[model samples]
Target chain A: METFILIGITGIGLGALYFLIASGLSLIYGLMGVLNFAHGSFLTVGAFVGFWVASKMGFETSMPEFILAMLVGGLAAGLFALLIEQLLITRLYDRHIDQALVTVGVSLVVGAVLGGWFGNDLRMFPAPLWFLSAIDIGGAKIPADRVVYIATAVLLLVGNWALLKFTRIGLIIRAGVENRNMVNALGINVRRAFSTVFFLGGFAAGVGGVLVSVYSNGVSPLIAATYLIYGFIVVVIGGMGSVPGSFLAAMMIGVIRQFANYYATGLGDFVVVILLAVVLLIRPQGLLGKVRS
Target chain B: MLRWKYSRPLLGLLIALLALAPILGANPLSRPGLQQTMAVAFIWGGLALTYDLLFGFTGLLSFGHALYFATGVYVSCILINHEVVVWWLAALISIAVSALLALLVGAASLRTTGITFAMVTLAFGEAGHVIIQRNFFNLTGGENGIALNADRIPSLFISVANTKFIYWAALAALIFTYAVIWWVTESSAGRVFAALRDNELRVQVLGLNTQRYKLLAFVISAALAALLGAVMLIAAGSAAPRFADAGVTISLLLMVVLGGAVTRWGAVIGGIFYSIATTRMQDLTQQESFKTIPKWIGGPIAEPALVLGLLFIFVVMFAPGGLSGAYYRLRLRAITKKSQ
Candidate 1:
């Protein structure tokens, strides 16, 4: 029972991280209709930036200070995304393969530059002392850091849901996702909406990156590709542009991965791959995705 | 000059030069290193041609084609090293296996078009890489990989250690692949593939089974890619998991794009150009004289990934149609000017 609880907690914590990353990917795909292959690179950049900031602030910093650093990092990533969207990505709109290739190129550039600068070594963000401690609950010990991560993820998820449900910009984004032409016909600036969504996606990815770095205790250039694959898996399983579906899929994958890791070393990735293939074969549109007419 | 009458002769001349490149290397003026590089380039050229057959001709942007290539390399290496088969037999078996694998992967992945197909394939490619690295059944030597014993290798492949012999073999392979692709592209089925690329729904509406044709193209491409992988294994006497990496697929994609998609001969040129350029870039960065350059400016050059990424972006932005497309346009302009 204790082992199960521990696994559940870990899975949920990891799931939260995956959700943060995949939500951004899902949103960008939904609103902009552009699959940003460079999404993971944003996470990598954000993590590194956040790490640098936190390291500079010293270990004595509180949780709020760390959160502030992560926010600043996310903003930086958002700025970068805006520039990329304006200069390059906007031109390749609706050219699916070209968009993929261009974004892949962008990812490669980002990853390579980071790798060159960081010397391919893993860098860690210092966790607060409280986060390093564990609390006993009903004979099961759970790490406080994981609880914090889960809380953050839940808060972000709610915040995003509310933003999409209630805000004007979110309404425009939702409309764009359904039918960009229809939204444009309504006289909304679809291009600006797309740019805004792209920036938000970048911010989400940036925040996810910071959280992941803190959770995993290290960051590396390879994280971009690895997490990109994970994010894609989650998005594909959940159905592209589906937020709730992404969250559900992310959690399932997180748990599945945890179990696989415990039972068979190095089999976790293969299991995920198999699951994706099976899912793709069974439901071409994904678990929660609607058929795009 | 852009007409088939002119281009056909030019292509023939290029093939003839490639065939005689090893003989040309017999002269001291031509370096052995050049021969080796060309050999590797020819193998890459064959791979690129296969990629173009799917991406350019069939309009399928598969990101997992390296799975088939790695399958060929690892399977052939394992069979030959274990004395289960000679190099020729291993190559044949590898080709078959790769075709079968392609059929399976295609049947599943082809259900989705565009980005979904790419993502599915990417997932499979990563899976293959992980499986190989895991050394399932101890057949794959884990990450250490399997090296073929020189004694176990067939006599024909034994001579592959000779740079000239490998050069000639790779040239022959490239020419053979090019001929096969050329024949296919000129066939009725090839026309169907072109139609599919232009618009799949239109082809489907025309009563043609687009799925079957797509599968056929995919299987052929996979088989050829595997053949090239086998050739590389024969040349190197070993196979590594790195061959299955997504980076390899990206490199092949780069070659296809840089040469010009939908153009067979362009892929061949692209492959050779990409291989040579990458090698030259690394060499340049490693030279002692490069140390004198400032760190910031020189830093990116030392990292080939950065350079390749930048090159990809530059090509996509400024030269979407690639070198072949540019040349064709230039020729068209000249002819129009003359007529004017």
Candidate 2:
């Protein structure tokens, strides 16, 4: 039971990171219909940005320093996203295969760039004071870092919900998702909306990247390929355009992975892939997807 | 109808020229290294063309085609090592088995389109790669790879003296593969595959079974890929686990896309271009002084695998129709001006 809970905690920690990364993927797909094969590469960029910032700040335990680094990393990732959107992705809009192919190219370039810049080593920042102290709940001991990560995830989720539900731009973004053509027909600059959505989406991925790096204790260039596959699986399984669906599906995936980690070691990637395949076979449109067409 | 200008006669002539390249360069380009590169490129060209049949003609982007290709190498290696049959017959059986596997995979995965299809194929490919790398090590020869007896096939020319049979065999296979593809692409079924790519739903609405057509393309592509794999192993005298990995799928896709996917001859050209650039670039960057260059820039940038990936990006960005598309554009402009 202790091992189960501990594993579950770790799974949730991973799921939280996945939820953040895939949420961006879902939003981008919803608004733009892009597969964003380069999404994981963007995450790598963000993590590296955070790593560089942490190195420069030379702070060991300050929450403010971490927050600043995250913001900077997010900004950098957002700028990169804008460049892709303007220069490459925009041209391929509404062309499904072209979008897939172009982004794959973007992924290769970005991955190569990261591999070149960082070599193959992992990079990490020390946990803050709050996350450094573990707390025992019942008979199970949960790491302080997991708690901090999960709580922050929940806060971000709530904040995103509030922003989407209440803000004018949020309503416009939602409107755009429902009918991009109609929104453009209404003389609303759909391109600007796409830009904003992409920025937010990339920002979410950037935050996820920092969280993953901290939890894993480092970032590797290969992580982009490894985690990108998982993120796409989650996005597809959760329903391409559904934000809430991604969250729910992420939790299920996380829980299952936790159980799998308990029963089998060194099989986490395989288990997740199998689960995704099963889900795809059973529900082609995904769990929350509304239409079969 | 299109001029039908690129006929089988032209293709035969091209193959004849290529087959005689070593003889033509009897003194120089016919050297072992050049001959080996040409041989490898021809076999790879066969693989890339088959890949194009699926992606370019049928409009199905598969990330697991390497599964069949790799399966062919491993199975043929096992058969040859066990003395089950002659090396030639082993290749046929390997292709048959790989086709059956592809059929099973295609039946389940081809039901969906777009990202789902890509993801499913990727899952299967990774699974195949991992299994062969780990569980099937006995037959696979694992990381050490499997080697074959040096004298496997009958040699016809002096070119076959030292690893020279590879060139003749690969060239023959290349010609055979291209002729088969050319014939298929001209057939009524090939037209339907092309149609399916343009509009599957419309085909279904027209009382034609798009599923069957997709399966046919998938199987044929897999079989051709298997044939290429067989030839590659025989050429290298060994088969390694990486032969069946996701990277091969990426490289093949890059080849097709880089060469101008929809263009038939472009696939072959793309294969050669990709093969030469990657190998030559690696050779250029091996110097100690060159090591100072960023790994992404000049050093490993020439790694065929990495270069292919970058080309995949560049092709999509700059040349949607691929290299063939660029040629077509230039030709059209020249023709229009002449007519004016």
Q: Can you give the lDDT of residue A58 in candidate 2?
A: 67
Which whole-number lDDT from 0 to 100 does residue A162 have in model 2? 82
TM-score of chain B as predicted in candidate 2: 0.91
Cα lDDT tens digits for candidate 1, A91-179:
88677677778888888888778876776777767757788888786677998888877887788788888988999998888888888
Question: What lDDT is reached at residue B272 by model 2?
Answer: 79
- Pairs in steric clash, model 2: none
What TM-score results for chain B in every one of the models?
Answer: 0.95, 0.91
Query: Candidate 1: misplaced stretches above 4 Å?
Result: A59-61, B4-6, B25-30, B155-161
Candidate 2 structure lDDT: 0.78
Q: Let me know the TM-score candidate 2 reaches against the reference structure.
A: 0.89
For model 2 chain B, where is the 10-residue window of minimal lDDT? B151-160
Clashes of each: 0, 0
Taking the tens digit of each residue's C-alpha lDDT, what string does model 2 give over B137-250? 377666777776545544442234555667888888887888889888889999999999999889999999888999999999899888988888877778788887777887
